[model samples]
Target: MATLHHSSFCPHSRFVRLIMAEMGMEPHLVEERPWERREEFLMMNPAGTTPVLVEEGGLAVPGASIIAEYLDETRGLGLSGLRLLPESPAARVEVRRLLDWFLQKFDQEVTGYLVTEKIHKRFMTSQHGGGPPDMNAIRAARSNVRYHLKYIGYLISRRNWLAGSQLTYADLAAAAHLSCVDYLGDVPWDEDEMARNWYARVKSRPSFRSLLTDRVAGMAPADHYADLDF
Candidate 1:
């Protein structure tokens, strides 16, 4: 079995987790806080990031993009579950584009700011220079998320999934970030019914069960986090 080192609220980590579940591969999970800068963890990933996947044979895959591609290349055999990446060159490019959109653009504009202020700051010690959450940053993130929700609604209105007719890495990537924000009660789901309806379908999947049940040590998810209907 492989071991996945990840943080509970890291959107990139969550992306990899969702992909693994959707692929029907269950790797052992090792909860890690990259800010702690553990020596052994650093040896595995010099980037000091969550979600370094280490295989039983000692092969280590760092970064969400690398891991997703690695899995798709190695385990994506035959007609099993939906392939995270599409077979056609053009479709694959679109999936990667949307994957980057959420991982980089959405993270930069919304999820990253919110999680850093709300979750990461809470875990940092005073010695590590931790302080109160930045209200201004939180407010900015909140405002930005509405635009993202609208974007999600717009995409789903035209296509079955974010990238196209198939459920690809694009959908998983978007959901991963949205799930983290939703956990903080920051997502304005009611403001966009289409986005909410699409999310409701993703939430009901067996692959999403583990994430929906994830509980941080001192923080509880919003009341509707695990509610399939909501």
Candidate 2:
């Protein structure tokens, strides 16, 4: 079996986890603190990011995007209708576009700030820059989240999922990031009914079960974090 090095609140890590679950994979999960910058971990991924997948034969796949593509290439063909990536090149492009939107753009604008300030810092020591949460960054992320929720609402209003009618990696990527913010109670779900409904549908999936139960060590999630009907 493969082993995945991940962090509980990292959206990119969460994205890969959801992908693996949807693909019916059961890799061993190892929680990694990237800030700690362990020598062995760095050797696996010199960039020191989470969500590194180590195969049984000692192959290390680093980064969520790379890992997602690697898994799809390795296992997705067998899944047929259940494949998270589409068959058509154009369709695949759309999925990758949304993947970039959520994993990179959304992260830069939202989760990167919220998670770092609210979750990551709490786990780090002063030597690694841990301290009281940065309210300014948190406030900016909070404000930015509303816009993202509105965008999600806009996208879902016209289609069954973020990229299209199919449930692709796009949906998983978006849901993963939103789930992290939702855990922090930073998402303004009530402000976008369409987005909230879409999230509810995604949240209810069996693949989402583990994420719904994830907890931060010293901090509990938002009241509705694990509520399926919320």
**lDDT values of the candidates?**
0.90, 0.93
- The count of backbone overlaps in candidate 1 is 0
Evaluate model 1: give its lDDT. 0.90
TM-score of 1: 0.96
- Give TM-scores for every candidate, taking all chains together and pairing residue i with residue i: 0.96, 0.98
Q: Which regions of candidate 2 fall more than 4 Å away from where they truly are?
A: none
For candidate 2, write residues 1-230 as lDDT tens digits: 99999998899999999999999889999999999999999999999999899999999999999998999999999989878998999989999998999999999989999999999898899999899999999998999989989989999999999989889999999999999999999998889999999999999999999999888888899999999899
Q: Report the C-alpha lDDT of model 1 over 1-230, residue by residue, as the tens digit.
A: 99999998999999999999988889999999888899999999999988899999999999998998999899876436577798999998999988999999999989888898888888899776478998998999999999989999999999998899988888888999999999999998989999999898887888899998888679999999999998
For model 1, the run of ten residues with the poorest summed lDDT: 75-84
Highest TM-score: which candidate? 2
